[model samples]
Target: MNEYDIKDTIAALATAYSKSALAVIRMSGSKALQIASKICFYANNENKNIENFEHRKSYYALIKDENNIPIDELIVLSTLAPNTFTSEDTIEFISHGSIIVIDSLMKLIIKNGARSANKGEFTYRAYINGRIGISEAEAIHDLIDSSNKLMAEASIYKMRGRLTREIDKLRENIKNSLMIVYGELDFPEDDTESFSYNKLIEIFIQIKNDIENILSNSKRVESLINGIKVAILGKVNAGKSSIFNMILENERAIVSNIAGTTRDFLSESIYIENIPFYFMDTAGFHKKADNDIELEGIERAKKCAYESDIILAVFDNSCNANDDDINLIEFLNTLNNKNIIYIINKNDEDKKFNYKIESGNIISISTKTKEGRETLMQALKNHTSDSDIYIFNKESYVNNREKSFLEMGLKQIDICIEKSISSFSLDEIAEEMNILNNIIGNVSGKIDAEEVINEIFANFCIGK
Candidate 1:
């Protein structure tokens, strides 16, 4: 038998072990309550038996060691089988958040017949016992590790089985299509319901379109989970660093009037409206670099802009457009599919810049006066808010694994459509449909392999 056998009663510290006001230690198994009863006693009545503790009700209790010596005072909640997270008899101890207290209680519980749970074992049990699907299991992990509000909301939607329901509906549609194909192949003479090739292709096209739509948002979901990278690019003395400081609301980058003062890029992450934005203040662009170091810095700046998701092209408003300014604009134009925001800095100075650019994403700001800061912030929020991942629109949001599976499913769909159009044997198309169904099942964990299930749960933290 495996070391993490589900039959063994398990105990673990559910909360962080740091010295806080309180912590939670949980146990689940057939003998969880029985083991808990051995180490706990009702605080109000020392003569009260733990077996008689009311389910789902908290009772102030006194924990004891092997020799029946008092350990600590805590509140214990008892729950019966088939109604808890793991679908097993469970007990939870809300105790003082002292490492020493937590360690003692864990040891006492083990000594009384409970064993320590392995990493993610609690959630593993929940999945194995059919309490939640694989998508919800992955969502639980994501929810715990989420850094931004958008990620948390997306994870919450997945945890509530939104993605599961969407996949189920898709699966049902595919199954119905397969049934029609089989009926046509089995009884060609029966004229009850004729199967039109155009009708079949239409259904397949709709399913393929649906899958592609969900797959399209995968990158946006990743950006929300991670963070959107924004690069600051401009000519020398264009106030790139100054604008960087204004955005961060800190003197993170050095502000100066001399050209080439910044020889390297500085990066800092900040949360704007609960969305994460990583801003990189790159070295200013120049046609002729004063030295090799400055030239290298300029190269790094161009590379940063190339790799960034958004670019803030800063221009000096106090001076007329020069070769460096025109060159910078041309370079920005060369980039494709980048969210470019033109920033006219030094608006506090006299207006001199008259370079015409045809873009609606332009804002004039003064780093000294802090003007247009709110508008710049609103621009960022607007760009990020366009992502569909933040909204639960009855569309499935997929992770890396699920996205790959769906892509494979889409390929199988294409093959099915091709076979149908070629007037090939319906058997071949049905086989492709079967392959697609299995791929979809893989996404929902309905027919997932044991190794895949283990790998999914392995990413979870211990004690869930």
Candidate 2:
């Protein structure tokens, strides 16, 4: 068996820690069948040698103690090697649902030399064993952990190999391109073996287009995994805090009409139209000649505006859109490419004559009356898309390492494609493509191939 196979039989209580109608104790490895047979009394199960797990199917049996005192009447499933989740021997005990009961059964399995698994371990093993790729592994975990229907659907699609199919197709394109590049590199002077300069240009251009598509789709992918990061920005007392509080429905920020009420940035994760979002309520921007604390908040607000997934620009409709607000809006105008929504707050006041704004450019709302807040929330949900579906709504990457790897791959491929278009250096292009492939594969630590299957399976819950 490949390294993905756990040499010793492994088992875990696959159900959640809480009470339920049923609990499944799952076991897999070379000795899984032996362990199951010892507790189950069925047709010659103890004396007769069983065929592959599937050939033995589920048998109505009495799960008894070592002394044959019946513990429970249950159904058992045995899936033989090469057909199971790990592509190894596996069996599942459909037993009573109590956590105590599941825990006892798991302890028994360990007593018989079957070790318990860990978080994300099962999906990890599946990837290691070739039952699935890294993408599939990630999807299954996402499917299991999905908090909403959209997330569930996305994860299920990914588990069914949706993202893998797209990525694999991309990989196939790169591979085919690699062959052409290497051929050209090997026969730099031969006309037939090398691609025509025009042909090379066309192929490189096509790959560039495809990579761009990947990056574009990746936007939806990241949105699906990590909901958009929307930074609510404006000067202090522009009702930025009130707007945030109204949207949250529970006062998350201190809202006072007093200027400089909010001296720092505040953030919260909220769901709008089932889309998860990280909403940051920022301090009012402007006046470097101010309280040091408030100024620091102003600086952070600007930083968030630049880096945020979406910029929620607030201007007071109750008063003139101040020059400060104009400056912020104008600066944001430079980022015409960013996803931004103008929230014109405090509509109850007089329509200011001086601060002119295109009404169409913003959602006019009165935070005191809780008006137009729903529109603002809908705006947030409108941009939330399915990323890897299962993993995050948007770039829901858990760590910087994963981010760095993807960034590296993106940059390298981007540069290589740029140069390939100009110089048509097949060697340089092929090198970059290969490096990209390695970076993607290494995202799950699969390149080394010796990481124990248990290490990966341990990442999963026992039931999975």
Candidate 3:
């Protein structure tokens, strides 16, 4: 059978197959209840089957093998057609959570008529049956894999059809604009009122602006979903590792007084104020490498600085700023405008270095005395916009798939706007509008729904 086909009964262990109080075996298809009926009998009577089992109700029953032998007592749940997750008859066997028990039950179900579900097949069926859209299917995955409450909340919003509604509204606006354009082209001699050239341009501009806003704010959504990367940068022996350990509250990185101790980037994910942050302890900056390994480490350090969303540039408060420190500051300037915080470490030590760096994003801290740690956290919070947990409260977060379609759509709209400004032919503009319609459809998965569905569900774990 094909991967997306839903004709055959599919079964899978929805819960983890480990020792627990209960494990759920999910089955969905036209023959799901039929298969369940063959294996499940009333707990009080082994010969009695679940032929008259009620829909949307749980039945206390005993799981049986082909010989009518009892295996385990389980709660059998049945949901009838047109109302289940896959919009097909569905059954769930809540058996005792034991590997042997689960394996036996699965074998019995398969023997009766159900096959193992492919990855995300159940959700795929839901999409194909019009029970859920592509975005909602993807949202199910996001909700399952979310690292924090904020990420889960965003996925919940999308699953509840916020994204679908927003995209549908935008597509409707585009279709209306196209209708106006087509009217002007088809009925050239009619005196009926239509949108003027300026009005069309205005509408296009507003749509583009809305798209741009979503894209610009996407970083916040991404950080909330995928955790923010914060890199610690400084010259050799600047106590960067110490600060890293302090932030992570563990000795994850080796702290030493030797220069250039960290020759490779070390990273760990930690939660700060309920927000996830990937704290990276990068190789310290060295002006001149003594070996090839050191040179490679320096390169990795530069790359980390380039990629990090927020940088913690450490400086020794006790020693004079060296050439490497100066070089690090200069290198931070060449980055893609990341938020840089100048941290003066060793504040407990006597002020020996002529610290001359100037910036409001500077804080002095001592890993020895645990000073200025709160301020550093506040700076990180501000840089990553952790204060605004409600960023996804109204607007839907754009996933990478949606982002690609959006960018393409925005580019075409910009082209249409340019053509409109140059007084291009109504037919030519109408052609662009037609292309725009397809692009919008792609964004909402209306044109390539099946392709999007496959790509999205393939990433999901089976039984979900």
Error of 1 at 200 (Å): 1.4
- Per-candidate TM-scores read 0.91, 0.77, 0.93
Candidate 3 stretches with Cα past 4 Å from truth are: 191-194, 384-387, 447-452
Q: After superposition, how far is residue 15 of candidate 3 from its true place, in Å?
A: 2.2
The alpha-carbon deviation from the true structure for residue 9 of candidate 1, after best TM-score superposition, in angstroms, is 1.5
Of 1 and 3, which scores higher on TM-score? 3
lDDT of 1: 0.85
Across residues 1-464, which tens digit of lDDT does each residue of candidate 1 receive? 27469989999998987999999999999989788777788787665556665568788898878676787899999888898999998899999998999999999999889999987888888887899888888888989987777778788889888888878988999999999989988888794366788888999999999788777765666666577899999998999999999999999998887877788999998997767888999998988888899899999999999889899999999999999999899899899999999999999999999899887599999998999999998888777764443443334468878888999989899998898888787788888899999998888777546677677777877788
Model 2 off-target regions past 4 Å? Answer: 1-5, 18-21, 42-57, 145-148, 178-198, 269-272, 320-327, 330-336, 358-360, 369-446, 449-464
Candidate 2, 419-460: lDDT as tens digits: 766774566667777876776555544455445334445566
What's model 1's TM-score?
Answer: 0.91
Residue range 1-464, candidate 3, lDDT tens digits: 27767788899999986899999999999888778888888899878888865779999998888876678998999899899889999999898998889999999989888899998999888877889887788888989998788789889988888878877877888888888888877786793465578888998998899778777666667766677788899988999999999988788999988878899999998887777888889887888888999889989988887778889999998899889889888888777768888999999999876858776488989998889999898888876543446675666777888888889989999998999898898889988977877886666556455665666777989789
Displacement of the residue 416 alpha carbon in candidate 1, Å: 1.4
Best by TM-score: 3
Model 2 TM-score relative to the real fold:
0.77
Candidate number achieving the greatest lDDT relative to the actual structure: 1
Residue 111's C-alpha lDDT in candidate 1?
Answer: 88
